[model samples]
Target: MSEVPTTRPARGRPRDPGIDARVLPAAVAELAEKGVSGFSTRAVAARAGVDRRGVHARWATSEDLVVDALATLTANLRPPLTGTLRGDLDDLVPDVARALSGQRRRVLQRCLDEVGDAPAITERFRRDHVDRCTAVLEDAFHRAAGRGELVAATTPARATEVLMGSLLLRALTVGDDAVRGDALDGVVDHVVALVSTSAPGARS
Candidate 1:
């Protein structure tokens, strides 16, 4: 009998990289229907056609799972980068306003309205959505700067907050009404004008 060569089996199940990617869209879709308060792991699992064990296997906690899902959804959205800062911002602002008016926006608003004392969810929103997008927008602003479309003195972080805050405030101001595209355009135009005008030798 010939001696059989044996290979040791790899330890544990190989990690599924696509698991989170697969699970997240279903989660976001569910979250869009149900606010953070009403979000359910079982429902998300059902929607994804996966068992709860699959979700639990990937995320240690529901907060972590939700954050990851929200982040993934945000990532899939492509923020436009036009050559001019105003044009680029004009492309981005409408999306921001729509998010403010859409199902996700209502879910988010519901959670914020009812859950001020819920530290876990609140902190997760702050860290996951707000901070992450702020960083992304800041990087976008830096890219504009590299292209010489932004003022040399422009602070990316502050600029991001200003642009985002305007949309947020406008959404709040209008309550449930759909924010008009013109309104978003106006906000983008205003911010871009402010930044561009501050640059040395900029056209009047």
Candidate 2:
């Protein structure tokens, strides 16, 4: 994988890279500033100080740019499998909550609020982001079950949905002020109680 540059050249500083380094960062900055409604190729190009034609040449549509940006947004969130379900949740849950806490939530909320107006954008957001997140979080429970950390199979799916729903709601409504220690912790304690073995960390 080609390294993504961590910092953009100063505005109008003349970068000669593939513009990937320039545009993706610019897209995120643009998203944070404008939400989804105001996001456009022209706007992102201006933000990156690159020609709009180059952006269009790279990402044929705004949806493409947004999807690529979404990919980078969660690129660092690798799941933790420490053999104990509670341990895994303790680590994974907070990281995910923090990811949802700031501009990430803005991306989702904006796409969600005007889903009909931008159906393609919204669908891409869900497919690229929401659904991908659900898959990772839901898998943690199954891993726990396989390791005999769950007593009764009380349906991890419902608990997973509840966990995700609560987090999304909290992030959208409450924002970062509600986040604590990188763990927004929406229904997390309840979900843990519902799915954990009687011994908490015991394995069969």
Candidate 3:
């Protein structure tokens, strides 16, 4: 008799499993429209059609809710990695810069201005948002290295920081509109050139 194969059951919620799932988007929308300092759980509840207590039960505080919701929204909008390290950075950097054109950047700036003094809130932003972005870039670089596009000594973490940090500064300055296409393309070409030249055989 042939043995029947059994597949493992899927783990965790298919996606978002929290009670916050329903209200999370609304909370993020409120923060984007109103800024972090201006958000109210009651208002979020009204928009989400759930009671204020429901939001509180899931997120506990306005800071927690806003941070988690924004993180989720940002995650959804991240650009796909284009396989090669340079291509991936090119794809990601401009889209990230473009995201500043939205209301979300105002929310982020407001949070920084008001909650910068709050260690826990700031830490959560660093851990949840900043680290995740860094990780995505790192993973892309690692994939390129596996494909022989990255050199043996070019560290994914260090290279990712340089690319992402530079783009963040540019985005902060660009503000209110998409980054100029020429400048964005210049960044991508320049970074790709640097990485390609750093690879072992490119110069020879």
Best by TM-score: 2
The per-candidate count of clashes, in order, stands at 0, 0, 0
Clashing pairs in 3: none
Best by lDDT: 2
Weakest 10 consecutive residues, lDDT, candidate 2?
A: 178-187
All candidates' TM-scores? 0.66, 0.77, 0.68
Cα lDDT of candidate 1 equals 0.69
For model 1, the superposed segments whose C-alpha errors exceed 4 Å read 1-22, 29-34, 75-83, 140-155, 175-180, 198-204
Candidate 3: C-alpha lDDT: 0.68
Q: What is residue 194's positional error in candidate 3, in angstroms?
A: 2.5
Model 2, residue 175: distance off in Å is: 2.0
Of the two candidates 2 and 3, the one with more favorable lDDT, higher being better, is 2
The ten-residue window of minimal lDDT in model 3 covers: 195-204
Which regions of candidate 2 are displaced past 4 Å?
1-18, 151-153, 182-187, 199-204
In candidate 1, position 44 carries an lDDT of 88
Question: Sorted on TM-score, highest at the top, how do the candidates line up?
Answer: 2, 3, 1
Candidate 3 — which residues are off by over 4 angstroms? Answer: 1-22, 32-38, 47-49, 77-83, 146-154, 176-182, 198-204
* Alpha-carbon local distance difference test for all models: 0.69, 0.73, 0.68
